[model samples]
Target: MPSKSSARLAALTVAAACSAATTLVLVSPAHAAAVRIHDVQGTTRTSPYAGQKVTDVAGIVTGVRTYGSSKGFWIQDPNPDDDPATSEGVFVFTSSTPKVGLGDSVTVSGTVSEFVPGGTTSGNQSVTEITKPTVTVLSSGNAVPAATVIDARSVPAAYAPAGDPAANNSVNGLPLQPSTYALDHYESLEGMNVQVADTRVVTATDPYTELWVTVKPRENASRRGGTVYGSYDAQNTGRLQIQSLGRTADFPVANVGDVLEGTTAGPLDYNQFGGYTLVANQLGTLRSAGLERESTEKQKNGELAVATYNVENLDPSDATFEAHASAIVNNLKSPDIVSLEEIQDNNGATDDGTVAADVTVNKLIDAIVAAGGPRYDWRSIDPADDTDGGEPGGNIRQVFLFNPERVSFTDRAGGDATTAVGVQRLRGKAALTVSPGRIDPADTAWKSSRKPLVGEFVFRGRTVIVIANHFNSKGGDQGLTSHYQPPVRSSETQRHQQATLVNAFVKDVLDTQKNADVIALGDINDFEFSGTAQILEGDGELWSAIKSLPRSERYTYDYQGNQQVLDQILVSPSIRRGCDFEYDSVHINSEFHDQISDHDPQVLRFHP
Candidate 1:
């Protein structure tokens, strides 16, 4: 979708034509038939003619991308092929800036190659390309091919077809079924010019100059305009990423539920970040729908309000402390207990073996008091230098911020990063041996992850057990748009192990006291319906309170247009049986352009 320099076009054409003639003379007559763009693309993810040279393939230049590291021009055959499984368009990758301009009728002679965007290890589908090409420009100013219209009707409801079992459950070798599967439909039109009209934005525009829009306006629609990822089966196939081919200053800043007015057309591209993207040559007008953040209600006199917020590697150096203070004071109404995740050391990200976070934690607490909130005190144990896996050298860990006026923290001696906490029976009740202590820190499940912090608190003559956790993140997992059908979630293996250890710890406390009040809350880093959540909620030991909301509202994070839950607060059987609790997924961030954090904080209010 970008244009190239026309000054060197004539010279490159002369040189390419000579190279083509010499290359063709060495080939025999058996494989000299004229090849089309569809033949180079073939019916599968990889081209059938990969590594083979084809001569005199004619097509009109639809788009010329002259920018970025991968500079290339897109060409589509004006002539039609009857097969829908094959794409008629392919990219001609020039090592540097392309010499050809838009609408140039050219015959390309090049070796067909399948280029994987993030290498083969990324498990991404390969993009068919013509590399080291020789070009012959027949004419200029030709009419470009008609852009294919992609709408709700064109995209299939099913996300993808099951992969073949014989090929390690990969869909790479399977013939594309454009009419049956949505991924296949996009694969069939990989490099072709496609258009969408009047689509609704499902994700806010980020600093990366990209946003997501949904063609099917009603697919898993949430009240706040994001597409809810309720289950693994439905991935909301209509969500597509859009990036402008023009100047970045000309790109529109949009939020969820906003409307992209009129038609926007571009060449369909596959990349490492988002699977399929539309590099728009003609962008649509952005119309704001006026989406706003949400606030939760204040807790009653006897009810205790608890919340969990991932401040996204917060340190004293960040400018978002005041904004986060306002969120706790105004949006959350100053909860009694706040489990804060990703609290970094004093000098953030400068790994010099400093692990204490008093400077960072006190700054946030001071900001909260300045925002007309409570005078809060914090409790946390600094992990061994670089033991917790987060922004390296920052030594990120979980900390509990409690209002002394509302609740009291019961602190005992001898709690550290390496020592394991134990449950004790004292005065016919379950209590933590060390108030703020790690749970199974020596376990292999928590090798480089944050250990769950166990603490005891008292409110209205009742003692309560609280566990703050920041589990292993989903870093190395394959995305939903992977070449392997039903992509492998390798990151979940560690999260599952972490969940099992936490579940055992909770079970230990419950076994000591049957009616103890337990609240396990923080960024779990997995979906509610995922295997990690199931292990955490083992045998009625805990219940995810986020599921208390409707199916549309059970999300705390937004990634690539899918609003899913990576943070959760699971209560014990005593809290679940009473049904005297309220849960809220406060939408202060994750849906806005100017966000302090990428996750929305969750709140739970109940009486002990």
Candidate 2:
């Protein structure tokens, strides 16, 4: 049964579709009769009437956003066309506070334009909008248009179809296939009011008052209620990012497993950071799922527990030292050897030729001891100032934190920032030329990126070689919602080269001693299934320990809404062939609101 407001809104919609009488009279003599909102938003991503002036475009204002840099109101025509490829709603960019209120019937005169968020070179789809609008309120207090429902059935299973080769493999020129692909399905509803009911949160509420929810709750569901990104082809299409038009202080603080338990209605928008986002006008109440952090079992006396944690450019003055200390002590259970990445210089980003990190490493060490953990000592090669690519002047590099009581660091001094480490036969066993030395530091593959730090250690009676790495990030890659189909990942070229160098270095150690115990662990900055990982596991010389876990539990980092693997631990055949190792992706920070770091730590236990 439709309420009175619904019935009135339906009638108004039919009338608007049947007649453009109100707009035709106000149209200038130079132009033809006024066009509807759908006509301005053509079947393609770009509007056909772009850069042309449109007069007397009529619709009922559904939302009024008085804040933000792009202040505007969303207007939806009550009368909609039969084509699902066209949207009935469009944003009127007022450039100031909108005078029209919600439910006010208005006619606007403006220039039709396609606004590409974050500039045109960003590879994002353009948003169709009416800019510099002149509004004329025809009437007040009319019912707003009904919102289109989006659910599991409405969105397609496939991500997108193959793009036309003539258009350089970009999907921008193709017509919308609303029922065939999820990207097209969302594109068909761009700028229109849509609703999602009983959505499950895949990404926790971030610091910017944004979160992500999935319409399909059961689609590749992980044990912790996150969408598992196991492969590149199986992109979880039901995931949608959410931002609020209401007060930021009142927005809900939610975790990954929480549920938005009612109808959340909003206008679908296309942006640069995230592709298709729902800017919610009516946000749903949060329902907690009681998600908790994870902890791993302690290692035995004979077993060596090695771990990797990216401290996210940690310095001495940061307030998260105590939290990071607690995470290392409590969540990770204080592994025997921890490879810590992103340890900044003394002053941390103050560009004054400062390249040392003793202060930062000592601060973290002191904090760990204060948190009731073992007295850990650190070793690292200080990178040249501003040479490694991270926060400028931060001089971020890898540091090894070892518990002297459990393991002994084999320190053969003479390692510097540019000196490359080599393998040698020391007393009929494989040994490093210089402990805590950089691997192929002069190679171009490591240009402006952190080089791998190789160190030698003796756990019980056998020697172990460990390499710590932090490869180049995916900064310039096109997003999933990009206009180009099969988004290009330009960042892989350097990472592939980086992986090749590290793999060759491991081969050198094995060539010296066939059964040499070698473990390479840190933030690989690529997927376990990616080519980068395959290169690291070249010809079965090394095997990734992350594969030991089930497909659903392999993620150590969460981005957008997909929980994927970025950090990894790969060991030689000597360690992996035995199949006696234990691996755990400790979930301490990534899934929480008050996170100390953006990545989860990974630990591996093996007998050396």
Pairs with steric clashes in candidate 2: 13-78, 13-79
How many clashes in candidate 2?
2
For each of the candidates, give the backbone clash count.
1, 2
lDDT of 1: 0.88
TM-score of each: 0.94, 0.94
Can you write out model 2's per-residue Cα lDDT over 338-397, one digit (the tens) per residue?
999999999987889999999999999899999999989889999977888988878999
Residue pairs in clash, model 1: 2-64
